[model samples]
Target chain A: MRPLPPTQRPNWRYIAAEMVPRWCPASARDMHYAILGCEASLFGDSNAASMRTSVISCDGGVVIVRCIRGTEDDVETALATVTDVGVAPVALHPFVTSGTIHGLKKKIVIRSLPSDEGNYKIGDNTYRILRMSGQKVDLVQQGIKQTTALYLNTDDLEDF
Target chain B: MRQFPADTNYSFLPQGRFVMKTADACIYPYPVGDASLRRLADELELRGFTGAIAVGIPAGCTVGNVRFLSGVDITANSVKSCRDALRSAPKTDVVMVHAGDAVFNRAILGNIPLHILRGIYHTDKRAFDHVSARMAADRGVAVDIDLSRIISESGSRRQRTLERYREISRLSRKYGFMLTISSGGRSLVGLRSVRAFVLLGAVAGLDELQVCEALAAPAALMSPHLSVEVIE
Candidate 1:
């Protein structure tokens, strides 16, 4: 059964944003798109509440994110890597080197490889490492794209 | 057709200063000349809003006068005022008009200046005789789809919605009036906050123009005070 609906539901972000000044440091509003994050009150440390939001859309270059519903503390662990915030945070391509793994911090590194920025896209799902958690990643290590076909061609239409 | 991007399903943005609409998108108790509407219009302008449309019989009003994108929600008192709003709205501003609930009498639908239909009102059936009288007037004028109140109430569902839209569009074309799809907010997420709605609209055969129009146009036209900027 659905829960009873609230009588007055002013857009939560607007309420949170409008109410922030009473308890916040930043007064300048994100007034254009008018998208407001609750973390507006707790600025500076991004990894705090601001770093974690739900994914809306992401291609190689462009990405769009949205508000997430969660408690105060569980925001980080509940989502992807802590590095997973921000617009185009990291290229999505997979590369290999081998570092170490403290359970989920699986890492692999390399000394040198081809240096190309445009070749790497945000949604490419690839990673590379050499030293991880005091352990050395092992490989004759091959780059991720060399063995997989996960890359997508999205050049025609624009949904940005 | 544009398809969903590969990494489209996921990828959260880092906590960078982001931009959002100036204020909450609200459906006011309009045509009442209340302070909130004036304040809303001013607030909208200060923040750069550029588009909106008045519901019911848009007769004398200008381009962004309307709110409550039909099927969003309406009250008994609000409905009558809305009909008055419709008749007095401007030609361009009167993008679309509603027939209220199909079951009601003439008083509810009133003498809406635009299109006529078997539009559904509140959940009650065998109801207000006056509203029925308003709707029952013009016959063979324009083909308005009489939907089951159960479904037409919040026509937000896509699979079922697209069909209703096609009918509305067809009728609009035949009558030489523009088609405006009412938000059947089954689960109405804030239009400003969600990107999923943009993606969904893209996939649902809405062209880029429509998607962008939905994003800012309604708010802009209805409330003139909102400032708007175009990104190239």
Candidate 2:
């Protein structure tokens, strides 16, 4: 493959930008392609060439990779063999957006019940607005002796 | 000497300090924010942990290069409830049971499917015995040895923990059941580096290769597709 021009040589940031658009909505198989593409672009052809035989695919978000003479064992070794190019697996979200509710520290209601210990509750009362972090929320409910923290997705909390 | 912490936030980990370590992954067993999984994956890649696994990930969350495995911790004593939880855990890649009464441990080991019994440890009572180890080995259940318990406790508790590990190690050798050593930390500070985990394993009477094998046990449990080559 021809190398990009000096001005256009894809850096990590550039590769990441290319990946962000397809990341969230892409299927697990597509996500594997994104990861491979980013790694190949940022780390250059040599590293990518070595990983050529390690075919990475996914089933239900679980990664399944195989080397040339692949078996279950080869997959593990292949995974360990990959050089850590310091590539972040997921895209970083910008703190600001064009919306009324900001990201973290914003108050949101517990639209859904939490599945873990992070949920805060009072006597017979489960619905309340809690302060949000990235995935965690500071829950302080009346009648509950101690405050608790909860995770967002599992809790199914909605923004108020 | 890779260590899988039972719970941790990759976002809170000290980038510089953690990145330099030899450990490749830290299993976060809690629900990480949808956006944070990606961000943390990016941060981990930047820090040289090209392979990090996050458990208990919620649905609709997109995973990048990082491995995302779902799991749930079963603390219930009722055999029916535990079995029900295991049966319903189709999305979970691993199932960790908090070992309590010996009867409950036997019930879990004998009846649960081999793939589903990923981890069984965490108890003051002597939950694992000769019979339990044999059952686990036959069924492919891994016995988890959480280093955080040894680090946090003191005096008699620490000694008991060490003794329990030694016994488990012996059983592991005799029966050939998989042993997984984890930090089981809730925070970055609680998480130990690979060197520390190896040393802790040594103190628990496990040799270096055994410790390494213990570290790799989780990888096998996470996916049926992963299997480490046996070195002669």
Where does model 1 exceed 4 Å of error? A1-160, B1-26, B29-39, B42-48, B53-111, B115-158, B170-175, B181-205, B208-232
Q: Which ten residues in a row have the lowest lDDT in candidate 2 chain B?
A: B14-23
TM-score of chain B of 1: 0.32
Per-residue lDDT, model 1, residue B112, is: 45
Q: Report the C-alpha displacement of residue B103, candidate 2, in angstroms.
A: 2.1
Compute each candidate's TM-score over C-alphas.
0.27, 0.47
**Interface RMSD, every prediction, one decimal place:** 20.9, 16.8
Please state how well chain A of candidate 1 matches the true chain A, as a TM-score. Answer: 0.20
lDDT of 2 by residue, B1-232 (tens): 1111222243323222121122222355333332234444433333333343345554313233334444555666777887887777655556777676678778878776534333333454467788888888777787777766655554566577778788888889999888776655333223344545665677677888878777666566654443467989
CAPRI quality of model 1: incorrect
- How much does each candidate deviate from the true structure in C-alpha RMSD? 22.4, 18.6
Model 1 C-alpha lDDT per residue in residues A11-35, reported as the tens digit of each score: 2110011110011111122221112
Using TM-score as the measure, which candidate wins?
Answer: 2
Q: What's model 1's overall lDDT?
A: 0.27
Per-residue lDDT tens digits for candidate 1, residues B5-106, read 112211222323222222222323233211122222222332234322223222322212222232122333345676565445444332333443443334
Docking quality of model 2: it rates as incorrect
